[model samples]
Target: MSGGGAGASRSDARRNRALVLQAARSAFAEGGLVVTLEEIARRAGVGAGTVHRHFPSKERLFAAAVTDRIRLFADTAQDLSDVTEPGEVFFRFFASVARLATENRAVGEALETPELSAAGGAAGAGREFVAAFEVLLRRAQEAGAVRGDVVIEDVRTLLVGCLAMERRRVAAGDTTGVPGRMTALARDALRPGRTVTELPSAPRRRNSVECGVCGAPVAVARTGRPARYCGGACRQKAHRARRARAQGRNADAASAGRQRP
Candidate 1:
């Protein structure tokens, strides 16, 4: 072959490979593992033969796609390396993972696969991600922000559970408040204060009254000075009620005094 022809062929091959990878990423993201190579090739402006040349099998392609995504996520963590707050970085990383997993069923399925798990059995990116989490967890505990009992393993378990619960809620079409509730629950669970246990018994109600104006449930302050009013609005309403009652009592007294006279 001529020198120019050989160089052109090599350039074309590199372009084809890049195109295939880009198309594979988009297709896997949009259609999951069932995405067709023919469709990927079409999207890449190439032939099915080109895709097969780059990735011999669907398994190989899927693995490549997942590796690419993991590298992207790791790069994101690297970007946050300058962040001084370890807990914030840690939760941010998990939040990204959760969002990615929720969007990609293939990624979720791959995570659950025993083969992939065994591939990272002792050491790999999975172990590294766990290590990164440990750094954050230890920092948070030292800062007295997170509970000292919360270990890396606990964080891992919670992350897995959060993903599962979020997926379940999405599938059930109950995604309205899932993110806020999940975040609140996670924060409470990781907080350094007293551990709150969920018992089988019904939740204890506060022995307080509801404000008539705003309908807010008002509990006695820990200082033990007040009864039911919580804030300015409720306090103002209660004050008005008291004034009306006193005026009524004064009027009745005046009427009785006049009758006696």
Candidate 2:
């Protein structure tokens, strides 16, 4: 009877542990690491005491989450090893990860945790990601698809920049055109020297003004290039101006009573 009781208790503990982990994963994916422990417990249909018994600390729970993601990312990379175009695979992998990180602040913060950074298994996956990236970079360099001067570190920096930009966009609640613009910037940054052309002239603006539509700073027009409007607002303004001029002419004629006819 004692043996059977002990076995049942152990089985219950194992089931609770699995339930907590599943709940943690969902919470982190939805609300990030900052999501409350109480929330996790509630979501898991467990109590705070149960959560503490399972994870002990927030750091431990966060570490577990990161480890889960690292393993998943590694498995994905391994599955793509046979891809003939390594560079494309490399860019796609990081780009997708960056997008996810942008959407989840908790995962992003967990990535910066020193404990997670120092973990041997986690560090190994990072090294593997870099190694795979290098393989693709080398192939692109050899094929003259990417600039010869570009290195693996440059690609890493680009990924970081992409993530930062995406985070900023999410914070500002302005996601329009960000992905497409980032993709274009990445292509421009990595393309071979021959594919890039020197601009015939610097983009000209008329005056410095805040663009009403996008809220970006706009430059005034120059000699050859007339500054119209910064974005859609400028185009609309120009159309309105033309209509106003035509209306004024009609009004004057009506006031003159058709030349006293």
Candidate 3:
């Protein structure tokens, strides 16, 4: 191939890769890994073969997406490296990670890729993340802001658990900013303190609340109005009961009016 032709081809390939990566990020964030590569290709305005050429498997694509995020975090840590308040920098970074994970569900899912451990392991790119986080942790400890005993591994595990808890609350339909609250709790626990305080109880939900008619437990969605009845049958029954009560009230009022002056 001619030199100019080869350069054009390479440029096109790079553009396609960038598009695929962007589509993967948006798709996975909105729908998790359930979104197929074909959908991503369509979103990226590329062919299926292009996506396959760039990312051999779903696992690889997932890793690449997460690696991109981890690298960004590493960059952020570098920016905070010179800050005077080590503790504040560390905690603020922690909160930022949690907030982003909350906004992008894919981050939380990537952290808990139980099934993808073999094929979808986090990129060595995370090594940069680890090194960056170590600096933050070390600084915080030196400042006596964070607990001296805590290590990076502990912080990682805690972050994963915090994301899981946030997802659990969101799945249970807690509209409140559970991520911010949980991050605050984690910050409190990580501080150099005499005793590790127990976390507060999760916000109560009515998953156990009985159906208005069938007396069965109502299944609540993560968003929107809470369901009062178990299904259409129960809902219809409740509606009928309310209509009947209204009719009975009307009948009684009519009877009383006839007897009155």
> Which candidate number would show the highest TM-score if scored against the true structure?
3
Greater lDDT among 1 and 3 belongs to 3
Instruction: Give the number of colliding residue pairs in candidate 3.
Output: 0
lDDT (10s digit) by residue, model 1, range 91-190? 6666767767667765654554414322322125545555555656655554456654455666666766766777777767884764635644665677
Total backbone clashes of candidate 1, pairs 3 or more residues apart or in separate chains? 0
Q: Report the Cα lDDT for candidate 3.
A: 0.76
The residue-level lDDT of candidate 1 at 163 comes to: 66
TM-score, structure 3 vs. true: 0.66
Pairs of residues at least 3 apart in sequence or in different chains that clash in candidate 2: 33-106, 205-220, 205-221, 206-220, 206-221, 207-220
**Which tens-of-lDDT digit does each residue in 18-59 have in candidate 2?**
888788877887777668889988988989999999888866
RMSD in angstroms, all models?
15.5, 17.5, 21.4
TM-score of 2: 0.61
| Best first by TM-score, ranked | 3, 2, 1
Tell me each candidate's TM-score: 0.60, 0.61, 0.66
